[model samples]
Target: MRQMAVIAPVAMVMVGGLSGCDAAQPTDSRFAPDYQGVETTLLDGDLVKFDVAMQGARGPVDVENYAECAAAQYALIRGYGFARHLRTNVYEEAGLWRGDAVYTISPALPRGVRTIDAEVVTASCVENGIPMV
Candidate 1:
């Protein structure tokens, strides 16, 4: 009876594990991101605004990342070596996500904790398949 009890529990666990493996797994399309586009606006001399949109984003962080990628590329295009994040506003409606972000481009590192090296950030964005201006 002792051996039978142990074997039954072990068999039940094994069957449970195998059944779990047969359960439906999440598809790639569920998490795949779709980058819509980006719009750039020069707010002031070194201050710039990035309006970015995307679909199938996981959350606001994805939208913010899109804005960051745009800022990085814009800084590089303007011959700036660094950028400082000023502010960002993220919104989602239905399945579309939008980010309105502002950043400051400078030839040298800006005085802020949210600063980014344009060259480095741009390279990372490209590697991660993120779109930039």
Candidate 2:
């Protein structure tokens, strides 16, 4: 009787554990997107540029600057998952950071990942070349 009681609890625990693990598995294609690529165009003829717009916690990027420009570059390249044979020059203007990055995105990305999350790094807080505040 004592051995039976111990085995019953152990068996129940094992069953519960198995059930939990099964629920943790990923779902089918309903949640996945069929990825292809994104569209690219020229801002200036042969200046070698592509324009990408992504939402940030603050607002649209000011690509005319430098640091935020770099961060934006990192975000787009990683977020869109573009191929090689591409490079870039990032810039900002009117408080919007832009990446004139050199890459050939398709007409549109099939994966359907809309937003690229990028941390805003800026030089505006510089005092003697050190970031303040």
Give all candidate RMSDs, comma-separated.
3.0, 16.6
Candidate 1: 10-residue stretch with minimal lDDT: 22-31
The TM-score values for the models, in the order shown, are: 0.81, 0.26
Q: How accurate is candidate 1 locally (lDDT)?
A: 0.94
Winning model by lDDT: 1
- How does each model score on lDDT? 0.94, 0.36
Q: Which stretches of candidate 2 lie over 4 Å from their true place?
A: 22-47, 52-99, 102-133
* Per-residue lDDT of candidate 1, residues 2-95 (tens digit): 9999999999999999987866867776567999999999988999999999999999999998999999999999999999999999999999
Q: In model 2, how large is the Cα lDDT of residue 13?
A: 100
Model 1 TM-score, all chains together: 0.81
